[model samples]
Target: MQKKILLSYIVIILLAVGISATTFWNTGYNYIEDENNEHYIRQAELIANAFELTRFDSANDFSSFTKSYADKYNTRITVIDLDGEVLSDSEVEEQLENHGDREEVLDALRGEKASVTRYSETLGTDYFYYAIPVASESFTGVLRIATPFHEISNFNNSVKYSIIRAIIVCVIIAFLAAF
Candidate 1:
């Protein structure tokens, strides 16, 4: 009877640990994703405002500007015209293929802000993208910023590990109490 009770307690504690770990991971990842996505959207918006204030219309000038801003934000920035043609890019030295086929660019062309996480074939890793439409009296376009998913993934892992450690400590204490 004592053995049975101990086994049952162990099982219950294991189940609790597993459930709590899963919940912590999922919740942490989603929360981080949402927070960073919105923050990047606002970053794009602020850059768009800066573009509006500037008189630099040359593609080279725009590229340099975006490169500097991308460095400041620690993310890649790409400016695309309404037709999805890449006008400027912080990461790409050469011109990129038309972005019209991209979902975020398409959504922005349709006047909606878009955020997404997807694996980039070119980068060989997952990335989070946020696109914001830029409009001014003289020019209009889309500004996109991308950051690697690993940044947020690392944060999620840290949070989950912290919770898992707490759960382990609690389980140990409870098992001792069971005696």
Candidate 2:
């Protein structure tokens, strides 16, 4: 009877340890993803701020400014006018047909930062879209930036590896304790 009780306790403890380790790993993964996303968003905002300082003589001048600046971060920037027109874009020479209707741009037009994620048909993968209001006094155009999903996905995989390592260490400790 005593042996059976000891075995039961050991099994329960090992099960608990496994569960705890899995939980810890999942939490860590989520934290890493969240942190990476926040950091990238901040980087996007900094780019927007820099674009604000370029002193464009008119809205048309914004095209060259966005192209030159956004290229550094592997992102595409779209400058949208208050009327929802694409005033300038980093990737395309012609105006985007759906510029004004885009949610991120609309939110920026309302003086708010907006971000969204969606699958890109062109890239054959997902991408994140970030939009923030340009700090211009007269125009209410938005600066929308896009980054491919692989940026975050790669970071996520790294996070997953770290969590798996931690879980393995925890499982080993649990096994040692059981023995």
Candidate 3:
């Protein structure tokens, strides 16, 4: 009888830990995604609204202007003309093919803002993209910003791991105390 009771207690503790870990991971991941998405959207809007090819006195300065933002935010920014041609890109050196077909670009071209979270084939990592159509007279284009998903994902995972470890330690302590 004592053997069965002890076994049952162990199983219950294990089950509790399993449930807690799963819940912690899911909630943490979702929260990270949401918070970062909002950040990207706000940044895209700010950039698109303030963007101008001549902001630096000439079109030649566009790269430097964008490079600063990209470096500061740790994001990739690409300026796309109405025809989908990439005018300036923070990541790619060579001109990229027409982006009019991309979902986010298409949405911006259609005169509406759009965003998506997906895996980037070029970067080989997941990212959250937010795009907005430029309204400045200096340029009529779309500003697209991509925020890497890995950092948030990895941080959340580390949080989950730490929480799971803590729970295991607590369970062990409680079990020992019961004896």
TM-score for every candidate vs. truth?
0.85, 0.76, 0.85
Q: What stretches of model 1 exceed 4 Å from their correct place? A: none
Supply candidate 3's per-residue lDDT for 175.
85
lDDT of 1 by residue, 55-155 (tens): 76577778888998999888888889898998888877877889898888899989998988998776789988888888766568888888888987787
Best by lDDT: 1
Each prediction's whole-model lDDT (CA): 0.83, 0.76, 0.79
Indicate whether candidate 1 or candidate 2 has the larger lDDT: 1
Give the per-residue lDDT digits (tens) of candidate 3, residues 55-172: 5445556677578778877789988878998877898777677889999999999988999888987779998888888856566878899978787677767877888789889788
Clashing pairs in 3: none
Model 1 / residue 30 / CA error / Å: 2.7
Worst 10 residues of 1 by lDDT: 51-60
